[model samples]
Target: MKEILLVLDLDETLLYATTNRLIQKEDFVAGIYYVYVRPDLEYFLSQLAENFKLAIWSSADDVYVEQLVNKIKPSAVNFEFIWGRSRTTKKRMSLTDEYHYVKRLSKVKRKGFLLERTLIIDDTAEKSMLNYGNAIQITEFTGDPHDDELLLLASYLEKLRNVENVRLIDKRYWREQVKSI
Candidate 1:
């Protein structure tokens, strides 16, 4: 089946990390992401994970991100991976952008995703090059599941995961294949 590797953002994208609208949480003591995931979170992610390979990218410290991800998703429902970073270690570019994330995803080829079927879901369209076809800009949630936008994004991700088969990149450009076809 076709697969997707997700580089989900921590704040505004998946769930708010803090109430003050700050990505950097200082007063929380442990310096962890602080926010309550919405009720639709589980059902939405459960469906998405069924068809996609998940990876968390918070820009939050790896150590802290792990704890927070575990708490937010204890059942491992939608998270196949738990990553933490905005900029790739080598290129030093922001991964929130589809171009950067696509490049960033390439670095981990040997380690994960034999197929470069990856996508980034974030609230901010900070990076524009990949904005048109490769992304879904979600409105940040504030513990309200009634919000329609969050519902739509979740539904969209779930639907995106199924494409019959996943192709391996192996010395080839996956995006090129998608574009050429």
Candidate 2:
């Protein structure tokens, strides 16, 4: 099978970590921030591993990113790489005063991945905007125990894996669903 790179985001995307609460094993507390993984996150990762070469590209620093990832995939066998803010470039959004750390697919391409065969799964659209049609913008996971987005995403991605060029799979499938609402 041809390999397709599936780059994932950590915070708010696959999991939600807040500094507002007491820290636990499930939570990664760095200085003052508390990070927590989404429910069924492990099963979600396992399912995706069946169809894609997974990698985590979080905007968080290296230490924090690895810590959070280790909490989930302790053996790190399912992921191909763990990329942090070091691989990202910062950009200030024109629409807002806040700056966004953009994770460009070009970086993944530089790592030898065919751009057409790669997809970025991030909750924040702004983070994956550069990739356009090659992204799956998910709703931010706020630690909801009943969240089923990943489960549905795994099904969608598995189906997408059969296609020669995943980029041709219009991201509008999710957008259409949103429009009907």
lDDT of 2 by residue, 1-181 (tens): 5778889999988888776763345455656766667777788787777667899999988998887787778353478789999988898887877888899988888888888888899998888778897889888887666778877777677767767888877775764454454
Top model by lDDT, which number? 2
Question: Candidate 2: where is the Cα deviation over 4 Å?
Answer: 22-31, 74-76, 175-181
Candidate 1 lDDT over residue span 37-118, tens digit each: 6556666667666667776766556777777777667475656567765344423255543333222444445566544366
Q: What is the C-alpha local distance difference test score of each model?
A: 0.54, 0.79
TM-score of each: 0.62, 0.87
Please tell me which predicted candidate would have the highest TM-score against the true structure: 2
Kindly report which residue pairs in candidate 2 clash with one another. Answer: 17-35, 17-36
**Residue 44 displacement (Å), model 1:** 1.4
